[model samples]
Target: MSSKVPLPAGTTLGKSFEYGIDVNLGTYDVPSWQPVRRISGFQPSPTPQTQDAQTYDDLGAPNSDVTGWSINHAFNAQVNRSITTGLYLPEIEAVLARTDPDAKGEYAVLDARWYHKPESGAANPKDAGRGFFTVATTRQNSGPNGEIEVLSITLTGKGPYDKITNPFAGWTVTAPSISSVSASSPGTNPAGTGKQVTITGLNLTGATAVTFKAIAASSFAVVSSTTIVAVLPSDVAGTVAVVVTTPAGVSAAVNYTRAA
Candidate 1:
């Protein structure tokens, strides 16, 4: 959905919507949109009915129509969003206030939490990391008249953020900090095309040269410290590694399979 705020000219968005969660206030919010899945079309306007509780027929009836209902009434458009908050949340209190204003005691509250552990069929954390940080908490009434509703919350740290996103707490990267690496050629195996590859593993910057061990003698070339790009030597095939060295330390050969 759009407001009177017109977007800047020529701004296009990709597929997928994003959401988020906030621990500060123990609330869930929609933070942003990330294209994780492919999409063809969208329903930009779905009648524009509100999600808040009302006195009328169940889900509040349309407040008239969005100017011209006959022209376009549905919100069906591909939105590339990073975060959007204030989503619909059917508050149990709202229902109690409207339906049972005076009723007190012995009532249940419908607060929700971000369930990462099993039994809470939530999306995996790694997959979610690429997406937004959001969740919904709908305080549905404990009684019969309380129907299902939703309120989406997006997490936005109020304070300053680090220049570089540090790894999540209690997590570590396991990729080896190796010494050196090399790539072989698809000498015989037709499966692998002659793919040019860059070997990685050690402090390889300012390297004098990178070469194919058994493939070609002249297949060596100077490269940067962290990585070195090289072509597939003609003689070699299958997996092999390239050696790398610097003033600090020498790296072990990192294996790379050859492509035909």
Candidate 2:
């Protein structure tokens, strides 16, 4: 089924695969894996293939082995993740401290999800890429430049990864939150074109970017965890989604408008 939706004229489709989206992990009730720095290694197992041999028969027709045929087989799945230290995540800690742990065993079950919102258009704003997984190993690394020690967790799954519809049932995604955003000019400029804007939110520190409708701000300053100043990019007249991407993950998007 398909439906038509209205959009402002001259509104161009923005780029896809913009990085810095937040990734969360955990179970249905006591969801715990969160505040993750970044994640990767979400891929499917390679398909195993085999072919049958063919030969010419007395009737000059091709004949193939009756038992020889290609078939699909199940394989183990794997995922890699990197997260900050010091928070001491209880979920992962308990799994690591288990008396008996195995990558393929059911001792370390985990669930993961990543949120991506389109900068423009009537995007659902909650497209979550999710999967069921298990932790295989956890490694820690550090550098000499006073960098904080980061822990990397390797995950493996029994079969294929699947999506989760209701992830935030009990616990929330542990990351920065955006409360409000406004233009710094004297009057209300909905378009926000070429105007300095201030965004009020939580966990604005270590913010890597501030975007208007997914268009990155050329210049921005993080005054504090609750405030960020940025110059809005010129864009088509329409409602836009604004968000801040940090090392921890991307913040929930806030709505902004651009006047014609």
Candidate 3:
């Protein structure tokens, strides 16, 4: 049988390769043992469990269990493995070329994932330094008590990204100008819905985001280049600092009184 047959010196059983049994039950996780195959004429419906959107742990995060790193390293270490043998899909040369010209991103590695499952089996799976895989569960072969899925993975990350964007450029980040700021509608009788009121002041153009400094207030919502439309915090009923900032620097606190 194929099970007893010996694979060539450098044989890699792809995730799609059939081994005639539930790989979960089999020693090497053969697709045959999976629900996609065992069950006759079965197809899983797409749902939250199998979201098309994939979520991943941060790279080098505390403990990205993501197993098979060693195998990945070994496969990547080959550096000179033959491509025709299906050893490497994302070649090192192409990897280096597509990288950002920032750090030493010239070198990158690639891995595979399941189409609808990721919660099962090992990710970045490798075999004898010749084959690699990322398994997902599927209903096609899973039994009455089984689960199925496929995982979608991509080659991402070279380093930690700086999540900060500069908002201040040629604009001078001077201390905020005060022109009678307060938290009150036009007037109960004929007042503006304060819900959409505007605050006019100097140095409001470069303020990308704004925050209020009322000890009891929640954070504020920045609405425009210079103005802010914040929900009144339950306890933000008094004067507080209206601080504005830009990528270049922060401005002095401008006091805005909350109407009683």
Best by lDDT: 2
Which model, 2 or 3, shows the larger TM-score?
Answer: 2
TM-score of each: 0.24, 0.37, 0.27
lDDT of 1 by residue, 63-101 (tens): 442332111111111222234544222122222232243
Where in model 2 is the C-alpha error above 4 Å?
1-174
For candidate 2, write residues 1-260 as lDDT tens digits. 55878689867665543211222322344232343333333333322333455555436655444542221112222223335535343334433433243444454455555444344444334444455455544444445676544445544443544443422221232467799877777586653567787889998887766776657775789999899988877777788777786655567668877653
**Candidate 3 Cα misplacement greater than 4 A, ranges:** 1-176, 188-197, 214-229
Ranking of all candidate structures by their TM-score, best first: 2, 3, 1
> Per-residue lDDT tens digits of candidate 3, residues 1-260?
46686779744545432111111111122110111122121221111112132335434434322322221111111133345764322232233333435424222222211122212232232211112222222223235664442212223322221221212132233534435454436653111223322445555654444444513223445455456554444432456555454433344456665543
Give residue 72's lDDT in candidate 3 (0 to 100): 18
lDDT of 1 at 159: 20
Q: CA lDDT of 17 in candidate 3?
A: 28
